[model samples]
Target: MKSLCRIGHSLHSRGLTFGSSGNISVRLPEGGWIVTPTNVAMGDLDPSQLSLLDDDGKWIDGPKPTKETFLHAAMYGARRDAGAVVHLHSTHSVAVSVLEDIDPADVLPAITAYYVMKVGALRLIPYFPPGDPALGEAVAGFADKHHALLLANHGPVVAGADLRSAQYAAEELEETAKLFLLLQGHKIRPLTASQAAALKQ
Candidate 1:
């Protein structure tokens, strides 16, 4: 709980997320999970107020889970190795999402080695109204193959082996998105598929 609060606050304070526009969750070893409460600003999350849910997704304690609980569950269900999930309505990432002509298969180009190594290929998920159950279904379908997804006209959702890893990857995604937007209309050099694959090794 302390770790969750600390990371959430850090992300919020750093402007990676704002207001009550994002949600985060960490899977528990004993089969349930802990998530930020609905409509609570990440910067203001009270450890004691974090919501708890059983493996089946039923609320077990604390406040109500974020309305996007199903989305978190879907990621967890799809990726056995996913230990944490971070979803944020970050400015640059959201801006990239709404832009037309970006390849949906790889929304952000591999502009930096860290971006390639940490974030990999970012799949773009078509927009769905926030908290819609269908969003969960869509994410689940690709969660196993991709660690990160950009929701069209929405934002980014990233899953990692743990919370800090997830947080770092999310930050990398945001930075890369910013770079992508800034380089628009300029001849930019992005890592090629072969170069990115070599970095993955």
Candidate 2:
């Protein structure tokens, strides 16, 4: 719980998310999860206030889970290796998501080696109203194959083997999205498929 609070505060302090604009969750080893509560400011999270849920998404303790609980659960359902999930309405990533020309299949380009290494392939899911069940279903469709995803007109969701990893990848996705937008209309040099593949090796 301390770790989750710390990460939440860090993300909020760094301007990655503010107010109640994001949600985070970490899977428990004993078959459940600890998730941020709905409508709580990330900067003001209390460890004890975090929601606890059973494997089946039953509320066991703490405050009510974020309205987007289904999205986190969907990722866990699809990826056995996922230990933590980070969803943020970050500025740059949301900006990139709303761009019409960007390919939905691969929202961001392999603009940097670190982006390639940390974020890998970023799938873009179409827009769905906040807390919409359809959003969870869309995320589940590709959660197992991709660690990072961009929600159309929304933001980014990233899953990792642990909290720190997920946070780092989320940050990377935001930064890369910023770079992608900054370089728009410029003759930018993106890494080739071979180069990106080599980085994954």
Kindly report which residue pairs in candidate 1 clash with one another: none
Candidate 1 lDDT tens digits, 98-198: 99899999888889999998899999999999779999999999999998999998899999999999999999999999999899999988888899999
lDDT of 2 by residue, 6-77 (tens): 999999999999789899999999999989999999999998799999886778999989999988988899
**What Cα-based lDDT does every candidate model obtain?**
0.92, 0.92
Candidate 1 lDDT at 118 equals: 87
Q: Mind sharing the TM-score for model 2?
A: 0.98
- Give the poorly placed runs of model 2, Cα more than 4 Å off: none
TM values, all candidates? 0.98, 0.98
Q: Model 1 scores what on Cα lDDT?
A: 0.92
Tally clashes: model 1: 0
Q: At residue 85, what lDDT does model 2 achieve?
A: 95
